[model samples]
Target: MDGSEKPPRGSAAHRVEAALLEEIAAGGIAAGERLDETRLAERFGVSRTPIREALSRLAAQGVLESGEGRGMRVAQYSREELAQMFEAMHEIEALCARLASQRLTLLARSQIEVAQAECKAAAEAGDLPRYLRANEEFHLSIYRAIENPYIFEIAADFRRRTGPFRAKKFADAGDLVASAESHDDLLEKIFSANSNIAAEGMRQHMAASFLRVLAAN
Candidate 1:
């Protein structure tokens, strides 16, 4: 789950899970990286049970697969598989953009604009970690504006699956700035109040992003 679909607030296992999700999304953890419960426990200052539980949840969600011994590794997909997943993500995000444009509110616009400002600022400052977090927030704000929980969950799941993959495309401040700037046109279309236009804009945006990821790969 992404930060948006957080598993309750205070469960130890969930805490570990959430933290790991952010680390993975931010590219701190590489694809197919192996994780051991004991190491995770020590890193998080928690008992092994919670580490086990967290890993189990990730496994259940297909984010991790069993590795050698008692370890688990991050799920990594072949290029063909990633392309297929990106195709689906393209459609879902377009739908989300459509709905968000149709059902936009003042608060949602404010939130998106604020998130984008932070994203641009972080990129300009060459602060990758902050930009990653802000990027996630920017999309989450858009997802929430659609006012559909099921769609939000679907979008969030896709984001989680592709986060690490997408993170690879940004290797430096210039790359991050380009990504942040790309959002400007999309936001304009999303705020245009024309659902078809918004959807098409998002489709184009996602197409460019997918191509970038492929190039990076």
Candidate 2:
């Protein structure tokens, strides 16, 4: 799950981080908007110490960066940077799909099925939030089915870093329906146990998504 979705537990810094991440993903804090420590501390009912720690964590995650003067700002992606990131993600995800097509267990396949169903229902109902949630699960199921913790972690981290940009696309119902339909294509390829086909299917899907994001910007 993305840090924002889960119930926050542990230290004050962790809670602050989760809240900030949610705000960033929801676009409440725009790209390149400066984050004041004092303002955030007051907003979250915490102190500067935890707020500082949370900001640092976000910076490390590529969600925030040091600004011109002092504090940090939400990181803005350049067109080239976004293109490059999506290219890498496409290859990584495609490989995962290939591996998953060959390796998925019965339970893993069932989980993917359920996630896809949720996505379809959400899209038909025009529920953006629900569609995004189910979409994450749909992708994660493929990552888990690959049976490689390292690959799963890499995929999860990329998803988290790009969460804000991806969230923007959810506002369009046409895009949401297209995404749900693509998931169906991916599942069909995976279920067929055709590694090459599955990889290509995933690559095509990722490429389409990259274009949508680029167009939106």
Candidate 3:
């Protein structure tokens, strides 16, 4: 997918959750800010039940915190927690790149290439939103290339947790250019079917992201 397609109606809950998560990541909602269920329910045009479910799911995933009388708030990661999460994510995504390199079908590889092209175009045009979405699709394309549902799921979960930091990093021109170059290297390694190179490349790619986060704080 090119990242513009909407999720199926059957998966509306997931779509809602993703939208809310993106808002939080983009700083539309500040960290530690409590989310009112009724307000969100009205805003999203969904029932309180679904809003509650989505909030609880995010809380379980460590993207939100829920407790006595405070309701749900955007999660605030300590520096230590952020470091650990980024390291864990780097390791997992590195493995995914290795597996994807070895397992990618021609179709998957082509799809990733297309996403990369779109991301490059968006970046060059300074289209932040499009660039962000295409960037996400580019990585998801790699996860899909691995053809392992569990690996894809784990990578996505890690992404959700780190989305805010990632978005902020890419807002910098230098960081966006560096990220695009890393995508070029990653794609080349995958194309060559060099799993080790792909793994290392992916690790280095995420290392930059982690560094950016560290540099920010």
Candidate 4:
């Protein structure tokens, strides 16, 4: 099987959680800033229930933390925590790349090409936000291309925890361009269906990415 079958989409609560997480990662929501459920509900144009559910999920994922007076705020990461998280993320993504290289079907390859194209366009246009969004999709395409649901789920979970720092990399235009170039190399290797080379490319990409993020921080 091509593993190109689109996985089932997440629930509304999950969508809301993703939006909030993206905002947090993009620095729209500052660390230690309280997340008022009522305000978030109003802002997202949804009821409190979904917002509460989203907030809870973020908290569980360690993206948010309990605050005084029974409230919650954006979670901050220490250097050690950040390093550990990125290390784990690299392993997870590298494994996905290896599996995907062996299992990718024609359709899966096409999907990844589309994401890489979007990434290139965004990078050329100097659209940091668009590039970052496309970058996320590009990586996700690799994860899904692996055709292993359990692996995808685990990688996704770690992504949520480390995403804020990963997203922070776009703040540097030079880094953004470098990342785009790296994606080109990565896509070429994956499309070649060389599992070892693809995995190595992914590992090197993550190493470079972590260094960039570490420098930025």
Candidate 5:
């Protein structure tokens, strides 16, 4: 039997880093807003050492810009940069879907179907968070079905980085409905075991989402 999962407890540095990342994603720390280590340390009830470490890691991740005297600021992206990021992710995810279609086991496909049902129920109930969680589970089910650890890792990372922004776009009712339809199409293609069709379907789904983001912005 599956045991109950314990909650995560982060170290001081990790707490600071997570809070800072949340601020950035929420737009509380606007693009180019300077990060003051002292202020952040105090706010997070941590020391300067952890704050600095957090800032350094964020800078390395391209989430912040660091300079000798200027300290750090939230990273800014141009429209072109956003487009490029989404385009790269589209290609990667398409490949993932293709592989998943070719290799998905019956058990994995059943899990994906269950996730989809949950998503539909969430939508019907107007539960945004539940819908989002179920949506992620559905995609992840497909990723695991592919059985390529490296590909799954890369796709998961990319999805995590973009998730907050994507969630914002899907807050609209129309977008939510459209997204459900897209998932249906994706699942159908996968069920048919047509890797090429699945790849194309995944690409189109991502393209639609990217367009929605662009339109929102």
Candidate 6:
């Protein structure tokens, strides 16, 4: 299956949670900023019930932490924690690329191309949210190509933890466009069916990405 999330559910709480997560992934919310339920209720045009539910779910996921007076704040990580997470993700992604290149499914190839096109378009349009979503799907296409649920779940979890911090690197359309272009070499190596080439290419790609994120921090 493609990497797109399921169609929006009917539950208001679910919708709010997803929307907030997207904003978090887009770097719209900074760590340690308190979330006010009343303000969120006004922002999402929903009652406090859904907002509270959404906050509770994110808190459970470790994306948020308890704040002053029972409110919640965005989760923060120390530099070392960020480095450890990125290190794990880097190796996981490299392994996925190696396997994906070896096993190159037609469905995954098609999905990857589609996601890349979206990435380019969103980058050109300078839409950070759109670009971030497209970027997620693009990498997910590769992870799915490996056809291993365990690796996929591990990679996705790492992504969930670092998406916001990773997003801080892109400050403008130029940054976004450059990031999208950086995918080209990795895609070529992945399509080559050379495991070593694919893995190394992915490792380099992630190295550069981590450096950018580090600089942003």
In terms of lDDT, the best-performing candidate is 1
- Name the regions of candidate 6 deviating beyond 4 angstroms: 1-10
Runs off by more than 4 Å, candidate 3: 1-14, 22-30
lDDT of 6 by residue, 147-209 (tens): 999999788777767877888889889999998998988999999999999999999999999
lDDT tens readout by residue for model 3, 66-184? 64595988777878988998989999989999998899898998999999998888777777667777787898899999898998988887776676666766556655666677789
What 10-residue stretch in candidate 6 is worst by lDDT?
Answer: 1-10
The predictions' CA RMSDs to the true structure, in order, are: 2.9, 4.4, 5.2, 5.5, 6.7, 4.6
Pick out the ten consecutive residues of candidate 5 with the lowest summed lDDT: 1-10
In terms of lDDT, model 5 sits at 0.75
Model 3 lowest lDDT segment of ten:
1-10
Across 1-217, the per-residue lDDT of candidate 1 in tens digits comes to 4423435668888899988877776666778899978879999999987777788888777777888887899889899999999999999999999999999999999999999999999999999888888998899899999999999988887887777888888889998899899999999999999999999999999999899888887
Judging by lDDT, tell me the better candidate of 2 and 3: 2
In candidate 4 the C-alpha lDDT for residue 204 amounts to 92
Q: How does candidate 4 fare on TM-score?
A: 0.86
Question: What lDDT score is found at residue 34 in candidate 6?
Answer: 92
Candidate number with the higher lDDT (1 or 3): 1
Query: How badly does each model clash, as a count of residue pairs?
Result: 0, 0, 0, 0, 0, 0
How big is the positional error of residue 141 in model 3, measured in Å on the Cα after superposition? Answer: 1.1
What's the lDDT for all of these models?
A: 0.88, 0.83, 0.78, 0.80, 0.75, 0.86
For model 1, the stretches where C-alpha displacement exceeds 4 angstroms are 1-8
What is the TM-score of each predicted model, taking all chains together?
A: 0.94, 0.82, 0.85, 0.86, 0.71, 0.86
Candidate 4 ranges beyond 4 A from true positions: 1-14, 22-33
Model 4, 1-217: lDDT tens digits are 1122221248656678878876765455656779998898888788987777777777877788989887888887887888998889999989999999999999899999999889888888888778767887788889999888999888877765666666766666776677888898988888788999989999998998898778766
What shift in Å separates residue 83 of candidate 4 from its native position after superposition?
Answer: 1.1
Q: Evaluate model 6: give its TM-score.
A: 0.86
Scored by lDDT, model 2 comes in at: 0.83
